[model samples]
Target: MAGILVYAEVRNGAVRKASLEAVSEAARLTKELGGSVSAVLVGAAPANAGEVLGKAGASEVIALAGPKFTQYSGDGYAAAIHKVAAQMQPTAIFVASTPQGKDLAPQVAVLTHAGVASDCVGFTVAGGKLLAKRPVYAGKATLTVKAAESLLVATLRPNVFAQTDAGAPVAVTTREAGEVSLRAVVKEVLAAVANKLDVTEAPVVVSGGRGMKGPEHWGLLEALATAFGNAAVGASRAVVDAGWRPHDEQVGQTGKTVSPTLYIACGISGAIQHLAGMSSSRVIVAINKDPEAPIFKVADYGIVGDVFEVLPVLTEEVRRLRAAS
Candidate 1:
């Protein structure tokens, strides 16, 4: 009931960026909470993870190492996190709002008898208590909520919180998972195309809608994303419904919510549902033939032009700029 506990997620033996953001935010909150930050890394996290977490503001790193914790099973991961939270007895628990985190937060909350807040974009400490701000009504509005329970668990949206450097590296305390009864087991993980970024995690996302006409024309969108090098290809729900693009790439109310640094909407009319997913993006660029498209309203930059003619020039210009830099 003193410090903040962070569920530091690791992938490929490295900590995910979103988890670091959570830890950094927790560090900032410690001034008001008046306790150290404890980051718990579950499973087969690399040795350097503790150092990385320490630099990211973790006062101490807790390693839950064991064979059962290696692969992520919803039941197993939740059990492990609950055990750590129970032992630490932290005032607040923070988890990244990634796909894994979204599923894990509620389960952990239930185990620890805490109220769970999902996909929070902002936070404030009022009188030594945590207040979470989250998008409600499909991103149409923001609602500030305070958990009635003494222990509060919040899932922070990736890219929403700022990640900053903290103190130097700290000592890592190893812990055992002990015993867990898991109903399901993760035998293996099926990853997407190698090196391809998840839309939710990408820094830049170039999205297409039904205006792309058909799936064959997706190369125009891909070329633009490829030009940026770090950009990911996103699709609107309309295109996914039409089977023009895979559901994984869809960005909308029914799909994945993304808050990348830069979001470029190509040939998208910008339905409210689509806006609900990406309105939180730092900067938005919209391109469409119609000047009055809804996407232009939320866009920081707008290009009223045909996608066919604009995409090639934009791609080449991006490549030229990258080469020059």
Candidate 2:
């Protein structure tokens, strides 16, 4: 049986949670295929990073390291991955559906002439072929795609699959990222102001909309997020378009798609476009004064009150609960 290869995305010398999810999924799939699971770590990685992947279920961890990989270069990284894939010739290659993964997956597919399924929520193998289930039509419909090539390449959406440990150590190997001709190089990376939590990776999200009135009123949402501790702040498309929040904070079909454990929609009248982004959330709580708001339709819990009047009370209650605990 051919092996499975997972691209373990690392940043700041640690593997990202999304890549760990991919690794876990790859391990599960490899068991079904009766093959071993291997992972490729690109760019600068910390020592013992392979052991981390081992615990996450990779039987073999390949570290591709060099000064050229210190920072991300799309062309260079894609070439390195292609070289590794050529060497391994695995049955399937899995990548996380992150900004970097989005850029890298297609390039590797194109280089290898392989069929690719992007933003896959789930997949299954049958008759020696891989089938992937993905969201389409603003996530209102599911599209199942089958890979025709010998190798299947796919990008798994973040937070969709749970990560698990394999309870054993694996072999680690290092390789030099040989020379590659690059078209563009990332000289500098400017990061946004760090938040307590990243919206995409957070388990809980507290979002506000135009009903918050103005940008000055965002403190209410922040206070609520603070009460949650692990929560991130999000914004509706209307507010984002109005320049009240950054594009990264926007949650909608036109912006970022999120699937958090709990989603709190404050003062948002859910539009189809907005719902398309967050409908996958496990639990939804909608707070809006209008009982007729569309958000109530999808909300597991609903609150009918003005956000200004409701938020402070909710924040205080949460703080009180935390204090008591």
Candidate 3:
């Protein structure tokens, strides 16, 4: 039927925002491509998963449940996804450009003999085929790609697409997670901080750089993040390398790429690698003492001041505004 098949990632019995974004994009594309949008849940999905995905525009949801699928096994999950793709033969498969999706997409592509477009930011229909627009060369260039074969596997970048709510409750078909060779199995999944939103998924990111001087100064960034309420704290590569911050908090080409509604860079010099990760942010505000810092080049608003001095005032102002509102 040439329908779009979306891989919906579930974490702690909830649908990940990135997965919802992928389903939403597929739903929009299906309008022009003339097919339905179906989602596949690859783990211990919640019973309401179908309704959640349906609200996100999926017409149907397939749940691959059972003990074997509870823990992530690359080989097992890939085989399961391949099994479904073979049965459905969707023209295009959409997956979120997450750590798991990055590994799963290539394996699925190989099994289905489909070309892959990783970390795609946009999509368009060209000649009845899906064309994916993705950033290349450290986000310096945009490349539009189409699958050579009939099927294409595209990974949609997080926070780049808007998730739309559409359609009614859809039927969810649960299937036993069949047997597959397990090369490596994830024994445990430990989050750095429970209940803390990942920087990639946060609407606002408050990042610190070498200018923070020491780990003790990070409290300023944290205070600011707390003031913003939904903001996540991020660190530059230099800060991570110096061991002042953890690698998970790093935001650069070597770290996690983020496209948030607002990105605040404090004491960051704006290295090209760091810029590559966050240049796509909707609005950027750079705060550095150096007036000549490269971060100013891409910032919508530049503040020339010491972060230590500015952050306290900024945090207080945000608190004041929130209190009044």
Whole-model Cα lDDT of every candidate shown, in order: 0.90, 0.87, 0.90
Residue pairs in steric clash, candidate 2? none
List model 1 lDDT by residue over 182-289, tens digit each.
Answer: 778778877867777899999999999888899999999999899999999999998999989889999988999999999999999988999999999999999899
lDDT of 1 at 299: 99
Q: In candidate 2, residue 147 scores what lDDT?
A: 81
- Residue-pair clashes per candidate, as listed? 1, 0, 0
The parts of candidate 3 lying over 4 Å away from their true place are: none
Candidate 3 CA-lDDT value:
0.90
> What C-alpha lDDT does candidate 1 achieve relative to the native structure?
0.90
lDDT: worst 10-residue window of model 2: 189-198
CA RMSD of each candidate after superposition:
1.3, 1.6, 1.4
Question: Which of the two candidates, 1 or 2, achieves a greater lDDT against the reference?
Answer: 1
lDDT, model 2, position 151: 85
